[model samples]
Target: MVSTGLEDLEQSFSSQIRNGWNARPVFVPAEFAGMRGRLGVHDVVMTVERSTGRGFESITVASIQTDEGTGRGDAATSTAEAPHDRVSLTVIGLPELGSPLPIIGIDMIALKGTLSLVALDLAPTSTSFWDDVCEKRLFALAEDARDRLVIRKRPEFAHETFSRHAIIAAARPGCEEHAFAIARNFFTLATDVVAAAMGRVGDDPIEARNRNLAWRRSERQNRKEMNALARMFGEDRARTFIDAFLFA
Candidate 1:
């Protein structure tokens, strides 16, 4: 169970993302760096290709856990108390035409003792794909932590592709009700940001076509059933189902 004191830890994480947004360099410790180095190489390549409009053909997701003493041998032995708390959601975007985009990976790191979450890295399949997925997952995670957090969408050019990140932080704790209020705020904010990011791709004719084709070809009817249910139950009900699934 997460301690109630973790509210402060959550606030600190939010502040770090805000600072990183303002300054452009979010310094992650060596532990996170190692995880990125090992797991993110493919994501970097995919992001670059997608950003260039070269297209992506396929993608995959993987879960990894690395304890202090196991993977890195002697180097990891000394830092057992400061073990890296790393979890990653890697998305590999492949273009239908030309070569496949490099893998796009987003990482979330929690400092072991502090239990404070941090944005370790947002790397795309390609150098250019940086903008494609950078702030999407980070903001989503922040929203999960608190509802009142806000993310200002700002896109810039860096490392070849256009990139943008959302600055996220919690509102004042204020009262007992504030916890739920903050959580609601984050949910709304994250949903909006994610919608905007997906809109960036879905609005594209080619991407729409790819999605339609993929959906048609998929043998599992889960997507179709979900869509039908969404239409029948409306957005709120669909959301309730999703929330239950995510939290429960």
Candidate 2:
């Protein structure tokens, strides 16, 4: 299990939440060998979602580990890790369009250890405060781990095993409201990310290709869904949704 420092961790998060609101840090299993379970702290950053006009405070963390040793020769003979930065997006919504559950995230991204100057003496921008924050997170969707732990779905909840649309569609209970609500969060966050990623270049082509490929798949599918929703739910409702869900 849980190793140590659970109490201290809870106390730290307790201070971040409102006095009356519940802010329990839940234990999440570490999937990889030797990796320890993690606790999720909600309300890490609270704010109103612009899309769908819903409210949420982003979560604390959801991290996953995968093997990254290169196999140029024997496992031991691989060259020094070609450490590079990775680009990843965290979607803050649900398991499906129809379910207001945690997101389904598959993070096999690996980073070779980097050499850096200690941050204690560094400027705020240069400090690794956010780095620690990212490290603590094991997944974008809390239920991704939750499902596997409790067998929320038979055969496990591995995102790698299914397409995004299939995952969302299968889990949907056919409720428009919940699906739209969760989708609103997804769209709102996506708009912000796209706005940020626009005109930006990655460190390399592979990074750009991987990031764009994922984006295209999601965005393309989303547009199709948006069109279908308009036909079924009326253009006015769809228009209103798109307008509210996306950022200028």
Candidate 3:
């Protein structure tokens, strides 16, 4: 069984989003609609490495979904399941930021099953506001996925699995500020959860130290980029935008 506790899972996902957003170009002149329309559907393949000398293992052909629709409530919710037709691959690579690198690619798959809710959360939504909400939800799903993957080395999440198989379900779209709040709450919660779990499970001192080192290195790199962004857009505005999109 994989050793992903809920806390670790959440932390891993939160870290991924933080890095992805922070590393992205400061200004994407493209309008939200353009970005949404260009969204790609893909399959996720995840590879996990165990700290306990358990070696490494992977799962392939997982589904990913993205929806960027204009509807405020109903329409936003309805499109959440749109990525069911594609398969995604997530490769674990050398530490890029504070977490493993996910080299993502997508493919179309003929065999259909309900997408694991955890995977569906990674989908893009219609606007920044909706994206923020979905980002928080996705972190939740990531937490669940980490746990299941650690224990089973495969996707698990009864609710998500069922949702994938059933008629499509919609996620509530929220205002940008509200969505940002949700993502922030999830990040804090997930961080706490993982820290507690790590404390309980205990970790190899060497590995822990190494991870801390990697995190610090990543932090330095992020700070440099953040500084550059601050210069491009006034510091205050840059910070505000970064805070908003970091999780979205």
Candidate 4:
């Protein structure tokens, strides 16, 4: 009984990302909130990007289709029924803004107890994207192994998890700008989402603030695409804002 489609979602999201007026943080990058609990949505939502085959661009937030509660937990990726009670957030964006079809982007989703799905958007946005995608499989497998083990608190999990979380943290603000057409940064929306959700649920702010500090420090830099920007403004001046990816 799905009444909405990608066009509807895209138009809705593009206009107001994660940091929109009604979004978390009160102001910032593009992000999607359920909006007073699913933005008045009563049905399970599934939105797909029109131009990309990358699974990250699309989002499905609802209960797990099935339950894989028990597994080796060896970094193996298995899809089950979406977690019914837990919030699942997915942030998707192109490899570079305005890139054509076959979009390359990252998708980060959190499950009830752990990440049911996580991966870097490592494909080129072009007809030849498949070749890049093929090269990424092995890399992804290895990375997943580390991620799964890290989730379990195995060895070196702390450092890797920090690094991994940093990347995920970066995704939110990154996508915010991509969708809103602004200078981009990373992790702002992600942090704000968690903070808002915690505050909404009455989680301890001190504890949340403590964790956010580490997550904040874990933050790192990202792609600074500004060639077109340079053309708009003078090169010398635009270079100063190369890091500037968002406007509002």
Give the alpha-carbon lDDT of every model: 0.30, 0.25, 0.28, 0.27
The C-alpha RMSD of each candidate to the native structure, in angstroms, is 18.7, 21.6, 18.0, 20.0
Best prediction by TM-score = 1
- Tell me the deviation in Å of residue 248 in model 1: 36
What value of lDDT does candidate 3 attain over all alpha carbons? 0.28
lDDT of 3 by residue, 20-48 (tens): 32222123323211111212232222222
Highest lDDT against the true fold, candidate:
1
Mind giving the per-residue lDDT tens digits that candidate 2 earns over 1-248?
A: 01011122223323432232233333322321122211121001111121111112222222222224322344322221221111111122221121111222221111122111000000011113212222123224223323422112322222332322221311221222332233233333333432333343333434333432333244334454346335434556445433433210
lDDT of 2: 0.25
Candidate 2 vs candidate 3, lDDT winner = 3
Put down candidate 4 lDDT per residue, 24-102, tens digits, no spaces: 2222222212111121111123222222212222222211111223323443233212323222333333222222222
lDDT tens readout by residue for model 1, 1-248: 12233333334433433342121222323322222222211111001101112233332222223233333444443322223332222222323332212222222222222222222122222332334433555445455434533332322212222122322232232332333334334334333433333323332445444433342233122353235325434445434432332111
Off by over 4 Å in 4: 1-34, 38-86, 95-102, 127-248
- What's the C-alpha lDDT at position 230 in model 4? 41
Tell me model 4's lDDT, rounded to 2 decimals. Answer: 0.27
Quote model 4's TM-score.
0.24
Poorest lDDT segment (10 consecutive residues) of candidate 1 = 41-50
RMSD of 1: 18.7
